[model samples]
Target: MAQIPSPYWPKGVPRALCLPQVPLTHYLQVAAERFPNKPAVIFCGSTLSYAALLARVEALAGYLTQRLGVQHGDRVLLMSQNCPQYMAAYYGIMRAGAVVVPVNAMCTREEIRYYMQDSGARVAMVAQELLPQVMPLLQSGEGDALQAVLVHAYSEGLPAQPASDEVPDVVLAPRQWADAPGLHGLEDAIAQALPAPADHPGSHDLCVLPYTSGTTGHPKGCMHTHATVLASNMASQVWRGLHMDSVFLAVAPLFHMLGMQGGLNVPVTLGATVVMMPRWHAAAAARLIEHHRVSTWAAPPAMLIDFFSNPAASERDLSSLTVLSGGGAAMPETVANLLQTRFGIAYNEAYGMTETASFLLGNPLARGKRQCLGVVTPGVDARIVDPQTLRELPVGEVGELVARGAQLMRGYWRNEQANQSSFFELDGQTFFRTGDLASVDEEGYFFMRDRLKRMVNVSGFKVWPAEVENTLYEHPAVHEACIIAVPDAKRGENVMALLVLKPDFKGQVSEQDIIDWSRERMAVYKTPRIVRFMDSLPKSGTGKILWRQLQEQEHARLATSPAQEIP
Candidate 1:
């Protein structure tokens, strides 16, 4: 493979620091050596030291291998929230040389079924509340590939104080094979197993199989190796200047890459204590920050919005929060500034996908930039490519952003066609097309413009929908808005803005008011001509506004409209 281009590498990332030869096992082993007595994880009022966490990982690894007959490369699905046990199960599977497939805990039965069948995961550790979602699939003879089910209590069974739960018999149905019990209690199994030595997973070994919905339309398993995970963690830590003893708040879902890599794995790599929460609640998060004295907190823009808006915001003491990072989606400028000015926390932003193993680029928390997705980190290369010509674009020119790095996925699991199209060779260097349209400034700061798929052609001029929507958001009346291209006879496509007004606004705001608002701010050709008010807009499971779906729905409505009859 050709070496990464020099211009793409971020400044200050020392080229002298060599990538580690040992895998994730090295991370855990180092933690045991350095911060053995420090709290590695804090889940549900219980804290686990690094040494104790390692002991549990070893015991669980033994149970999975010796008792359950799990072998090398055997896929084990982990479906749970952000908890200590979940981490134990994930690392345990990896330590046993088994591949870990983490499924989104909030996915519907159909969605879970697709991942379960696709990964061919023979074993699954399911949270008790989610048993209903996975039970039907497991019992319907559809997920026959699965060999065993391990039931885990999300709120129970810490090392010292175990939470109480009345284990329900009906929670699980018996399987055909009597020897393979359908529901194996995780606590019981871990309690019985003797601590075994941790197996050293090699760099080439597949560690995590994180499912991501790519631009290709469906979700696919992004095959992340031990090297990719470790490299990504190292890059993020170095770029962010995260301290080893820092306390991080784990509010993002562990199933997602942002939460898994940024919120969870990054802290573990530094031997830091992670304050865990199964789900995000603004008041609870603030309390945790005050109670745990969490030094760092990373979440989506919505989470911050909720935190600042909460009634408890005035009462909570959030002085410990020094680094407030945002991912999964863009942070609103107002919200970003409020967190910085009011809370005295720097807003750190990251830009990446599951394919890049969480973050390829991030701003340092100490001197973080809230707007742009900061410069590229070390061990990675980035370039802008022309969307149409498939040629490299100049640094300041707008084009699709592509990345090449040691952190890139091994490939989409079992999908050769996708793997082929995902990466392109330019001047003997392999670059993954990110599908996001962006540009780099003279200072190497990257700015996202819009999604190529989201670009709308109004008459002949290309109108970026995000620009229109972003401008509309600035309007006092408009709380949320989306712009789409609607078919028209006069113009090939007319710009239509869908908007939701602020709930407390007393004065009436017409569609023309929004159009006039945009007309003043933007160019005549770029302004939205058509406008429609909505009570609410549809959103994806990940909290992303589904603009394409909204556009399609508008088109469908217009296509089937009845013709007016002349009197």
Candidate 2:
């Protein structure tokens, strides 16, 4: 049960890791000192060097502390697309001794409001493109808790107008913040601001607060300190053999843990350049990869599917690409085979979550299997265990995969009940229960078989059924709602809503009507793709919706019939 990893490990890679002990911002500090002139981020056609980037971060840090009255341990909200402003604000929040809470930029007003109210974030640095969704929360006079808001225009931080059509229209278009009150210009503030006085936060000081869609509740914040978050970033750089010359194409959304760790944090830690993209377009990605000679890119498998299938990518110079990696969903065998035969590149697969900061297990860069997640990283202790019994299983046995490592989060923020369920004690050590059912092979390679939770993963996005069902309950025409995951051809899974309409609206409200209403109320990723009207749901005497019974029934029917239904 205590077996080590397979012999198929990277030749020069270490089995254990020792990371930088300073604050997360220290990576930027050291990078500036070592490679001041090297580009820290390349957005559009222009570049922001390490020295300039660090200066901007410190300037904004000063503004948060000196001008905005942000204090240590206080939370500051950040909502934006992948761009240069994200980098500056992320580090600036930490450098000022405040915690950074990054939320998905695509979240609806109802969802974003919950994040703001739940995190107790009074101050925020948001992109101008997303200001309309956040404008309603600016009133501190009401019960709204917002104090100060800093708005940054994506184009203002760019060197010039981006020529590529891949950039999001919101970022490409000029911002209209002319008459908006309480919306201070962040770019302008940093331009005229001075560096803040040194405020040294301890290694254990809380830094990043990333939200995760829990198994049974709304999104809960995973509290991570500077030390805990740094472990994965350092390990990624070491595991991938990244250096100053390595160029990471930032296609993954930075708001997520995987992107924050590998796409942005790993590259910045080593003074390497990150090619930031505000939006994902396969053709545009091809142009940038060819033009910049990008060496490494980590994104979702969906992006890779589009990139390789698109003929536009073939026109570009992909000779510089050496490492292509991602994790949300498994890469198809065909894509992996093509990468191996044509590009001589391995699609490095890894496993991680917001609670783990990033990669807990990864395929070796040199040696890897088509669909296997490689050995556990340097300092992690992982094993397959019986989900209900908590007993470690023998090799190749199906069980719940659990991990204990430095990359683990401190715990869920302020929710002791949630923390109690998420972690358990074993052998005098505490380990986080991943709640994902997986198995370890004789060779020590991990394989994911299924999940124990009712959550849905749509193209790497976590869609909580409870969250979606709660939203549907607010609909006037919906009497009862239950969300389930169905097989999807493109995405790994698609959200399906099974509902029993109210007597008054049985024929009045259509399925399309419910779907359309949801799109306006929640994030598109969390919206239900298919809606099924049932005569009545299988419920208990207490009137509790029997979600699992319906889910299992659907699974049994789909298993017997290969032909699947879709939106």
For lDDT, the strongest prediction is 2
Error at 142, model 1, angstroms = 5.8
TM-score of each: 0.88, 0.81
RMSD of 1: 4.6
Worst 10 residues of 2 by lDDT: 539-548
Q: What is the lDDT of residue 60 in candidate 2?
A: 93
- The digit string of per-residue lDDT tens for model 1 on 341-402 reads 87766678888888988878766444445457766777677778897776887768889988
**lDDT for each of the candidates?**
0.76, 0.81
lDDT of 1 at 305: 60
Mind sharing the TM-score for model 2?
0.81
Task: Give residue 252's error in model 2 in angstroms.
Answer: 0.7
Please give the distance, in angstroms, between residue 443's alpha carbon in candidate 1 and its true position after superposition: 1.8
